[model samples]
Target chain A: MTEKGSAFLDLMGGEVFRDGSQGVKIRLTIEPHHTNPRGVMHGGVVASLLDEAAALAIKELLGLRPQDSGPHLLVEMNVSFLAAARPGDTLEAEASVLRMGRRVAFAEAQVHRGKTLIAKGRFTFVMQHD
Target chain B: MTENLSQLGIKGEAARSPFSGFIGNVLEERRPGYSRLSLKIEARHLDSSGRLHPGVLATMMDSALGAALRDVRRKDEEGIPGGTVAMDMMVLQVVREGEELVAEGRLLRRHGALAFGEAEVKKRGDGTLVACAYFVFAIGRGSPR
Candidate 1:
């Protein structure tokens, strides 16, 4: 899941990986621009990373391809920040598919800096086909 | 002479933001328990689906809710300052590039070092709600835990 066309990922930065060969995961380095006023990883960045991971996971579970399955949109997402990450820190996030039905898919995710959990959340993804 | 949230600090922060791309985000105003922010949708903000990226909306809620919570912390007489520690959000509608977004957040309550808050975002033109969120934060004057 390169998501090569997403400029947001290009600017904010993210790397997508497959989870268990069935789920999706994202890795991001806490960059200078990713920090907030206090210099910790911005909550916005955390949220975005989670969303991206969830989207990737959903696509994997649903077998939705960019050229075939249309598109996947976030129906809902929630995140809880457990710890703070700083610039130069490499954070890895992974999403789990809790369930996948007809229209919606549920997922849970966590971002960790090595052993430290930075954040965790769940998401609802809805697949739209054209 | 201001010892709090100096103009220079805000200006300096606006520079390094990751969302400072095409559909750039701007911090418009901040007040105790409340804040207003906006983003101008740009071509680059779109995803592979040719729609506004969900992460962008999440980022907006993240920044807006955090800013509002920051102001709320400033008002705390205890003199504690921290940052947004947790957030839960929902995307209620779809969005696209070229559509400006306006977001606002207000504090729901504060207990000790923790603060609870909620925020909403809508299209600037028709005020159609696109997304909303609730946030929790921990603040301290020196380093927010």
Candidate 2:
């Protein structure tokens, strides 16, 4: 796996890795600050991880760096939460691009803890070129 | 109108999710089937492109909707526990750091243990719609986790 880095990914404390294929994976350890009142991982954190994973996958598929491309805007996303993640649990999200067009892209991502699927998401992004 | 979390009868620590606190979302109002929250875009909330990250908007939407549901549920006679099941969101516009955005959530309906809600995010001053979302929540699930 090859490591990739970004400012938002770093702020979220997730480590991104390319699986030598079209897929990208992001792993994050749940922290106290990541939890909701019920002490489970916040839904927002889950969504953020899924979004980042899918965005990275799209970036890798296009082979475009941030500077090399125009603005990449997330146009739509649908997410389903299947289970709850608690503090101390390490969650990993894997994503891959489903389709790529001249100005748009589609992707899907699943977040898991071990073998348990915690959440899944589908994303659409509008890509621009300079 | 700005309101304190405590004024909404939400216990500070119990109602304030750590992640929400980390992001600095302030509760603006809460009533039966409705809630509003505001966030100030900061450097940390922006992506490499200097625009507010969509994920940050998602977080706010989820929290705002959940708060709306929670408020209504607590007023219910049963007071069942619930959690978010699914959400669909569309981002129509983007904001930059130093801007303030407000999210308003409203419970649309409830059937048995299922509740549906919608949220809209807008620029605080001009009320320009930034994003909108629909959410599904499962009540009596004994906590979302």
Best by TM-score: 2
Native A-B contacts reproduced, model 2 = 0.67
lDDT of 2 by residue, A12-82 (tens): 78887755655667889999888765567888888898887777777767675432223568999999999
Q: Tell me the spans in candidate 1 whose CA falls farther than 4 Å from its real position.
A: A1-5, A18-23, A65-70, B1-23, B74-81, B141-145
CA lDDT, every model vs. true structure: 0.71, 0.78
DockQ of 1: 0.54
User: Per-residue lDDT tens digits of candidate 1, residues A39-84?
Assistant: 6777877877777666666666657642223356787887888888
Span of 10 residues, lowest total lDDT, candidate 1 chain B: B1-10
lDDT (10s digit) by residue, model 2, range B64-116: 88777765553352445456789999999979889999999999987667788
The model with the greatest lDDT is 2
- Candidate 2 chain B: minimum summed lDDT over ten consecutive residues — where? B6-15
Cα error, residue A27 of model 1, in Å, equals 1.7
